[model samples]
Target: MDTVMQPDVLVIDDLQKHFGGLEIMRGVDLTIKQGERHALVGPNGAGKSTLFNLISGEHRPSGGRIYLRGQRISGLKPEQISRRGLTRSFQITNVFSRMSAFENIRIGVMARHGIRFNLYRRIKPMRAINDEAHALLQQVRLDHRADNLASDLTYSEQRALEIGMTLATGAEVILLDEPTAGMSRDETAYMVELIRQVTEGKTLMMVEHDMSVVFGLCDRISVLVYGRILATGTPEEIRSNQEVQSAYLGEEEEH
Candidate 1:
């Protein structure tokens, strides 16, 4: 009998990034598999967010290669990478502050279809786009607040709206940066559940600091230290590994 293996969705091969005299990513290698929820956990100054920027095209890699579904994507513009079905959310809540929640999501849907907004057109309303946006609003549990301005939503609701916008692009691979930062414990719990639900059937990679959220929601965890990965394993394995205890988790427990 033979076992089936999941295909790799994203691969980082000896990835490196340098800022003038400083090296932020030092010969890093990582892989994300299809339909798996993966978490990147590390301490401050460990280059977690920098790695996300490189993958999402905010910063070009100084060396090495990045593959999305086996095609090289390094050096492409953010929109170019996004059009390839990979999109990311920032640590900050990014939304149209003045627009209604419905409008914010509709913008992303329009981008997905390559339709430009023309304020002067005498055209029929796009029922399909509207319907999809409404459905996405429902999916992120923001349908009830669909008509409210984005600025009026609560912090958690605003975060949920951002996730809805991320999904509106029809992305297959999603990168979420610190999705639970600055949330109360209850808010964090709510967010973890919402992330678990919405990311169903999608591949997700996130940089998170909360161990509970990482352990409770992710299928695998990668511990990065000083700009490189130290260990990658299941929650139980990460919890029990002696090296992980000394390098990261043990310090987490002490603080």
Candidate 2:
């Protein structure tokens, strides 16, 4: 009898990204197992967003490879990667601010169904899409504001709406870049719970600076500094690692 090793949902193998005159990412490697809440923590300018960009196909790696469930994805387009089960969210709010909450989610629902933006005829009459949009609103706890314009919602609500849009695409591996970046204490708490509920049974990887949010929500933590990974461990291990303390967390704690 042998134990079956679960395949990682995403793998960054010696990944590198560079500009013409300067290198940004240098031999960065990371593996995220299925169904784990993983966090990538680092200081500003450490290239956390750059890593996300490469993984999500917003930028191609200069060298090395990226794998989604062990399949090579280094050169694929963003939509292609997305269709393969990886989805990413930006730090800023990413919703249709002028549209109602329902409308914003409806667009995501269309994407999930492989509905192209050019097909207005098919989209206008889809009852199931409407139902799903309303259901997602409830799931994100935004049903009360389903008819409200996105601009009317508070900052935290907009973030929640952003998460709903992420989930609407039926993504199994989600990459969130600083979901709580500009949130206050209570707002972050609210969003932590919202993310937990929405991402159930899915693989989650996030880049975050909020230690409290990271410690509360993630099962594993990877510390990145100057475009390189310094350490990867459980929250407890990260909290006590001497090298990590000196290199990153110690500096963060002083603020």
Candidate 3:
């Protein structure tokens, strides 16, 4: 007898926000296997961000369900979802500008270790947290700047630190929103490699605008337009898809 593998994650059915009576996400279904890298792409106003928000618990779904590892998670708070082994990084940098890079990552580690509210306990006594934080920094190649204030780091370096913070949370499913946004060509390339390394053996779902980054990193791509998923396929298929060309690539070419 052969055993069948279950999907590690499922967005069984989802209908997200509507603004002014316009549906942003009509009805969406998605499944992800363990260790899969899925990319979500769409034209502006297509609701890619909305979908991500729903998945990461940043926004409550207007309707439908979300499941992680076979457990329904729809309507859970963001922190609650994170504790269930899912984590996310935003399109904008969300770090403590006044804190040192090491300190910022330490906070993440503390949260993951369930020690964030321990006001009376000295952080210095948390050797395990310190070790994990340093390990995350090393994974993102920002360990050298661990003591630098997050605001003092260069744009690319700050992006790396942001990823490191996510890693510190010990998440199994990572949702990155434009991880390469605002980066130079060189920085983008470096970030691509770093993301690949950090996400190894994990399920990664990303909303990206850079086709190059999508093609380079994603194992599968889903296209969204006018609040509905237009298509889902491999990078090669997406590139050659006529519908995708007409809806997205063609527009980019014209600009």
Candidate 4:
């Protein structure tokens, strides 16, 4: 009998990042499997955001490499990396405040299809683009709010609209930074379920602080401590790892 293996979707190999005198990422190594939801959990200043920036090309690495599928993306620009099928959302909600929810998502869909804005192009019909954008609005459960200005939606709806925009890019790998931050418990739960549905069949990597959200929504968890990954495993395995408990989870329990 032969065994099948899931291909690695994203690989971080001995990655390093430095800010002048301080070393923020020190030879970090991690892997994300295809079609899996992976979580990065650690205390503040653990370099989780730095790692994401490095991977997403918001910042270049001081050393080492990042691979998407099997291609090197270490030094690529952010837009370049995004064109190659990776996109990310910020910790703060990022949406066009003046644009309606439908229009906000339509911009991303246009980007995905290489439709650049031009004064002459504006007069051309975009029925396909409009339909796709409306479908994405429905996917994120904001179809009712599609006509509303992004600034007018509730905080949770704004976040949902942002996620829809991220998806409109047709990214195979989605990195969400603190997607549930600053939400009430009900909003957090709604976001979690929304994420689960929208990220189906795509790769997701998120930096999250809420333990219940992390444990419930992710298939695998990576414990990053002091700029290094201490453990990576299934939720149950991470729950039982002594070093992980002492290094991060136990501290989380205390707070």
Candidate 5:
């Protein structure tokens, strides 16, 4: 028998949301391919975050559906979605401020291994978790800060630590919200490389405002405006889309 493959890792169809009488997401639709880096960009309050919240199961949608590998996920919990190989990073730093970098990552590693409060099962497995935590810290270039408190590191280092936790989940489909939202040009460049390295061979969907990051890192771009996708294409195509340029990109440059 021949094997069939799932070409799309994520699918959003007619996704809508309502807060009282106000409509937030107006039947938005998007598709992300397996092992592809996709970007979602628009102005500041164009429902990007709302869409992410709906997909990540932070908020339930009023209508429509989301699918991961053809199975519906719109109504699933965040943990349930994560268990299905999808995970999300927040816009704000979400590390445990008082914990050491090593300890924070070890918690995530434990989550990945489904290690709950079972003391009898914890002894021998802890060494392996520690090793994995160190490896993840190295990948994010924060190994030197392993013993430091999360609150003690620079802003950039803290963001890198968050990425390490995301990796520790062992999620194959990752959703990142503004990974480089607040960074100097140099810091942005370093994060660009870290994101590229850590998310390699995994499906990634990022909502970002930085055009340079979008154009530089994403395989395809989806422009969301007024709670709907205006266009989806390669970098060059989106750049030249007169509709896209006039509706969003051109306006973004003026600021």
Candidate 6:
């Protein structure tokens, strides 16, 4: 596919973030095309996580602008950004511990379908929403654990549910923060395949520490260093880039 032909769903123009007197993001520019799987990779404290937070409305930029499909969205609140088709999953799994797996996903579908605050109404009676939630669970291969509480699920299963919840939002642009963090080898492989399947035909921006996963899943890769983008290219190009090699992969090679 001619990935560049796709429209830019997210555009960052000279983006900068400052906390107190320290500049966290030093004039970064990025463009994320539609249906592209773009991986943002960097070392610890390189501001990969901070960039995701900034995009998802968790933090306001100190300078520069963020655009979603040509519309400015840098100043919008988190909920407003979500409503505008941007959703994010954190590095840590965030699920309703007390609710059943099915119920948790159902709640997400409800919110996406604009029924979240249906007070005095029984969620069980919402057949449409319930069915959608079940389908999402099945998509994530968690249908068998539908009745189990979120807290009862294994760590990997919980992470799957978290992705499902993010998908339930009907987001056009999904930001996944370390989706395979803390996973075993098998679990990581499974999660990678699951994410690939689920994100087909959607724009995905991910922050991943695993070089293998980044190379395997990303159409393009961006390297961040001390809150700035040092380079962006295809997997092979990034792998061969001297700057990337010296800054990040050199450390990997030493370990």
Which candidate leads the pack in TM-score? 6
TM-scores of all candidate predictions against the true structure: 0.95, 0.95, 0.94, 0.96, 0.95, 0.97
Per-residue CA lDDT of model 3 for 1-255, tens digit only, reads 010153556554656666668788888877776787889999998998888898888888888888988898889999999999999998999889999999999998988888856878788877898888888888888889989999999988888898888888889999999999988899999999999999988889998999899999998899989877888888889999999999998999898
CA lDDT of 144 in candidate 3?
92
Better of 2 and 6 by TM-score: 6
- Alpha-carbon shift of residue 89 in model 3 (angstroms): 0.2
lDDT of each: 0.92, 0.89, 0.86, 0.92, 0.90, 0.92
* Backbone clashes, candidate 3: 0
The per-residue C-alpha lDDT of model 4 at residue 165 equals 93
For residues 119-212, write the lDDT of model 5, one tens digit per residue: 7765445688889998999999999999999999999999999888888889898889899988999999999999999999898999999999
Give one digit per residue, the lDDT tens place, for model 1 in 1-255: 010167899999999999998988998899989999999999999999999999999999999999999999999999999999999998999899999999999989987887776677542477888999999999999999999999999999999998999999999999999999999999999999999999999999999999999999998999999889999888898999899899999998898
- For each of the candidates, give the backbone clash count: 0, 0, 0, 0, 0, 0
Worst 10 residues of 6 by lDDT: 115-124
Least accurate 10 contiguous residues by lDDT in model 3: 1-10
lDDT of 2 by residue, 1-255 (tens): 010145678889999999996888999999988888999998888999999999999998999999998899998999999998899888989889999998888888878888875644766567989899889999999999998999999988898889998888889999998999888888889899999998989999999888999999999999999889999988999999999999898897798
Q: For model 6, how does the per-residue alpha-carbon lDDT over 154-221 read when each residue is reduced to its tens digit?
A: 99999999999999888989999999999999999999999999999899999999989999999999
- The TM-score that candidate 5 achieves is 0.95
Question: Per-candidate RMSD vs. true structure?
Answer: 2.1, 2.4, 2.6, 2.0, 3.0, 1.0
